[model samples]
Target: MKLSDFELDVLQLFWQHGDCSAKQIHEWVCETKPSAYTTVKTIVDRLEDKGAIKRVGKDGRAFVFQTQISKDDLTPSILPSFVKRFFAGNASSLITHLIDDEKLSDDELEYLENYLAKKKKSKS
Candidate 1:
């Protein structure tokens, strides 16, 4: 299930804050994007249609929504295409970019090393 940038932004709200009404989402979005209420509602409606979110109940006249899909659910589907596009379908290139170009704290680098070690150990 591919999502547009706008859809991802809206989904992030649900993931971060749990269930909320379109108006509530609009208010939060407006803080950054200056989007209109109807625009935000349209995105919410699209998300509901896509099964990323569902109508849980009503908040007064507006419908309340909760996320059906998770960040984890979307990442595996999105990452392969992203890697294919930018890294020539090589996942190692992506990991290399993260290690070299992206900022990683010492603890984070240690964690990644440990994770790789465990993965190697499992294979062995």
Candidate 2:
């Protein structure tokens, strides 16, 4: 399912925090940027409509929400389109850019190398 940036942001909170009320989400989002509670609520409502989140329970008067989708569920669907749009569908180019241009630590680079080795071994 397609999601707006704000919807994804809200869903991320659910994914990270497990279950949360709208008030909690609004407060967390406000730490980075100023936003009205109603704005956060609207985004939460939209996420529910998209089936990205579900109302799990209630805390006082507020409705608690949980993620209906995992990052694994969403990323595979989004990545191809993202790579196509930004890297002309060349995944190797995208990986090259990330490895060469981005600042990766020694451990991170080692992990990627090991992962690639395993992938190659699996293919053979």
Candidate 3:
């Protein structure tokens, strides 16, 4: 399911914090930037409509919600568009850019090496 940018932001919090009410999400969102409760609620509503989230319970007058989708689901759905838009669909170029431009710690590089080795072994 495609999610708007705002919807993705709200879903991020949902995934980060687990199940929470709209009021709880609003409070957390506002801590980063000023947004009215209703606006946040609207984003949450859209997420529900997209099947990314759903009402699971209630807290007082507020409805509590949880994610129906996952970050893994979101990543695969969005990755194609990202590759098309930014890398012109060339995965090698994307990897090159990331390896060259994006900072990687020693641990991260080692992890990637191990991951690649595992894939190589599986392919053989």
Best by lDDT: 1
> Compared to the true structure, candidate 1 yields what TM-score?
0.88
Candidate number with the higher lDDT (2 or 3): 2
Q: What is candidate 3's lDDT per residue for 1-124, written digit by digit as tens?
A: 7777778889999989999999999999999889999999899988888888999988888899999988887898888888888999988888899999979999999999999999999999
Better of 1 and 3 by TM-score: 1
Candidate 1: segments with Cα more than 4 A from true spot? none
Compared with the true structure, what per-residue lDDT tens digits does model 2 show for residues 9-124? 88888888899999999999998889999999999999989888889999999999988899999999889998999999999999999889989999998999999999999999
lDDT of 1 by residue, 6-113 (tens): 999999999999999999999999989999899999999999999999999998998999999989999999899989999999999999988899799999989999
- Candidate with best TM-score: 1
lDDT of each: 0.94, 0.92, 0.90
lDDT of 3 at 54: 92
Model 3, position 66, has a per-residue lDDT of 92
Candidate 2: global Cα-lDDT? 0.92
